[model samples]
Target: MNLQQLYYFKTIAQLEHYTKAAEQLNVSQSRLSHAIGDLEKELQVTLFVHQGRNVKLTRCGAFLLEYVSQSLDILDRGLEKLSDFVNPDTGSIGLSYLGSLANFVTFCISRFFEKTGKVQVHFQFNQTVTQTIEDSLMEGHTDLAFTTPFDNKNIESVKIGSHKTILIVSRDHPLAAQDSVDLTTLANETFVTYSPQCMIRNHIDEIFQTVGIQPKISFEALYDSIVLGVVSANLGVALVAEAVDLTGCHVKALQIENEIPEREIHMAWVKDRYMTPAVKCFRDFIMESGMLLDQYKKK
Candidate 1:
């Protein structure tokens, strides 16, 4: 019913042991049990089932926990916004992006800071999958996200530019000397690739599917740099965007002869969401700096 009761319930639900929960909360076990019991009475529902040492949430308890978690998450976001407003000179901006765009995004961020040093930025590198990048924005976890386009009406996005996903192999690789190579040529070669959850990996998969060739994906990685490093180690070849940092790795980036569309990068945010001054300013700078310009100018 109250925040204290909900807090007690959440803690007990997580630990599933009243005694342990009490110790962790630095309160007496009786007090912990009394609070939870009062909460159950107020809600008119049995929230837990206990077996001597362990406690488990009943179906109603589980449902309540879901909503309780969501409420706490929203409260956290509100507090963050309030803090940012109170300190406008150093507004905080939460940014989310794919690993492949690290170099380009970093360049943009550095440029932004050069112009406005007072802004504080927090970054969430979502190497998991494309969905998470979008989710970060929609769930209020991040203010803005750089990712591929998705058909989510809840978001408003603007296309930045497109970049080519070039083929990368070790300098001593068998096909490295060639000017360009067909996708089919690498069919038998062991492949190092991004996780299937990655947007670029999905695009790469589609290219292979179109050519009717299934590559032997021996290893999976999240970042373009890591994939390239794995390839340079002669572990396997990979397909990564040209924005990947290749300074230290001895790798050859070959053009793919097969017709593959360039990867489209977009900056997306939740529609109608309040944009902090920091987020708004940097977003404008990013759009103007040409970092989002069509680097791969496809004919």
Candidate 2:
């Protein structure tokens, strides 16, 4: 009828003696008998019958025993799993980041594991654009995110580091010859840029507005690598974050002489959502090791 009644029935069914079961459960015999009597009345079935000086299960009791044992076992296992899920050193964290910050995330995670020895914390990583990352956080799909700063009342963010936005041109382009170029000098040049969905695109647009130049956008891509690939063909020059891997891309990352805002990286999470211990641990580590994480920036 209830958990306590089921437990008493299980113990009595196992030992087959009312006195022994009471001793094992540390309950008085009268209390155990009353609980069993109430359970039988509730179920309208006798669960035990007297056999000599001991007791044995009735036909219905044996059938009920099988189901009760299984249900209790499942409940016990569920409790254990919940305990492990809340453990700071052994739980899992769902982390999301921009594609460009993949290396930085790797560096931070490696250092985090090193500092917390014997940790069994699992990390699930998602690489996406800034808008999707923010959406993921808001929707509870991710526990933490590395992305560009945005205005969201329900999300909290802290600046981790920033990447210098630079101009990239093909090897044969005229601007590639210059060590540094002013923003005004490229006002007329056709530009390859990030899509409007990408947060960095907004920053790029702001810079264009501040410099009083309307960029003629010829191509738009979602990722920095794709934008670089487009620039490699000498199609158009692009302004992008400086920390991209340009190993096979034949584009020159030139310094911009004009003063512009750096593309800042931030660690963000839902303001009021419940965070597991592992997620909070990693979030605190990133907040404290901001400068250390900056050392692994792509050159």
Candidate 3:
């Protein structure tokens, strides 16, 4: 009926004597008998036969023994698995990140875990604001998120690094001849970009308005990869995060005659949430590894 009662019955059946089973189980003989009695009453079945100076299992007890043994095996395995998960030196750590940015951060995460050899990291692609993704982390849906310039007032975060937003043009473009291009020069040029809600898009729009440039949007895409594909076709120039791959494309940086804006990438967690030992180790590793700093230094 219950695990303890089942265990008592199993030991009693094995020894064929209540006194011996109780001594082996570290329980009083009366307590063991009472527990087995309660179990039989709950199950509405006789589990043992009493004869002159001898004991034997009932027919029902023989059948139940097989199942109880298997159940114990399963329970033992379950406990072992839970113990592994709770181990400080070996556990799983969950992480969420924006799609394109993973390419820049994956190496760092992989190397950190490899060196420690104590944590299993689970990574997810979650491209959302700090405010937006905080709920997921708080609700135990994710452990940490690698996000961009976010409203971090409500979340605990560390500025891991920043990515430069570059205006990329094809080699054949007229502006490619110049070492630098101005926002005003792009006013008449067709632009391929992400939706305005995207952090980079908002900054690009702000820069356009600040510089008095009114660029025409020829294509709007959700992903940087799509934007790059469109730009490779020479359909239009695009402003993208440096994490994007421009390989195989005749792409050239459109160095703005004025200053270009950059976006900060941050690793954020729920404020005051207790990080598991594995997660804490990873967090510390990321801070001391200098991988993000190295990435920011790249042109």
Candidate 4:
């Protein structure tokens, strides 16, 4: 029920063994067991199941573990924020972005540091950048996020600009020589695609559904890099953000007509977050660097 109990439960779930968790917590195994038992009794849900020495989180335990993890992250960020207040300019700016926006992200970071010379920036990449942005903003896990737009009502987002969607294929593919190809043309072809949960994947699916076309899917990758690699290996073709360069493996772009609309990438933060100085500087830099504008104008 309390932070300590939640923390104890989380530690046990993570270690997967009461004895090891006790050793790590610097407490007796009996005490750790009692705490977990008390937590389960109060919450009226079994948190873990044990077979001899090995312990695994039960369904309820897995659910609670998520809550505990988020709570810990909030606490850690809160502490970091407090520490940052002691020295504003040198404070860390936690950033997360989609892999497809690597170039834009790199350019933005470079420009921000070069221009500001006062703010320290820390960046991380997430395959699901939109969800990462939403979660980070909602849970205070990050200071800012560069992500694609999503219909999450819990955050404030500024649409910087959009990035083009291009069809990529291996050199040996028959359609690789085409100037552009219709989505309908690939209806029966095995397609290599990113995970269905990705924003671009959803957009691609919508386009296919609208046109009454279904490409036979060969693979689904979690990362844009992997999808491009798969396509270049002649596994299948995919529509992806143009940030990927298919130079290595007999690759070519098959432009889709009526061009699938560019995905809108944005800078997002929690709606009511008290903006830290470092975070504000990073945000200002992104808006000023024209990275978004440049991406919008790409051929």
TM-score of each: 0.64, 0.82, 0.79, 0.65
Candidate 2 residues 1-299, lDDT tens each?
78999899999999999999999999999999999999999999999999999999999999999999999889889989888877898888899988877877888888899987626888899998988998899989999998888799899999888888888899989888888889997778999999999998999999998788999999999987789888999999998877777778898988888888877788899998898888888888878876544677643
Off by over 4 Å in 3: 9-30, 50-59, 62-74, 114-135, 152-154, 176-179, 248-250, 288-291, 294-299
Q: What's the CA error at residue 97 for candidate 2, in Å?
A: 1.7
TM-score order of candidates, top first = 2, 3, 4, 1
State each candidate's clash count.
0, 0, 0, 1
**Candidate 4, 1-47: lDDT as tens digits:** 77888878888888899999989989998988888889889989998
- What's the distance in Å from true for residue 72, model 3? 4.5
Which model, 1 or 2, shows the larger TM-score? 2
Q: Least accurate stretch of 10 residues (summed lDDT) in model 2?
A: 290-299
lDDT string for model 3 (1-299, tens) is 67898888888888888778889999998898889888889899999998765568999999999889889879989989777555667656677676557666667666776888754544445655444456677687777777764565656778888776678887777767776777776778899988755566787787677788788998987667777778777889987776776677777776667675667777777778777776777788787765474564573
Prediction 3 TM-score vs. true: 0.79
Note the residue pairs that clash in candidate 4. 171-250
lDDT of each: 0.79, 0.88, 0.74, 0.75
Residue 89 of candidate 3: its Cα lDDT? 74
Clashing pairs in 1: none
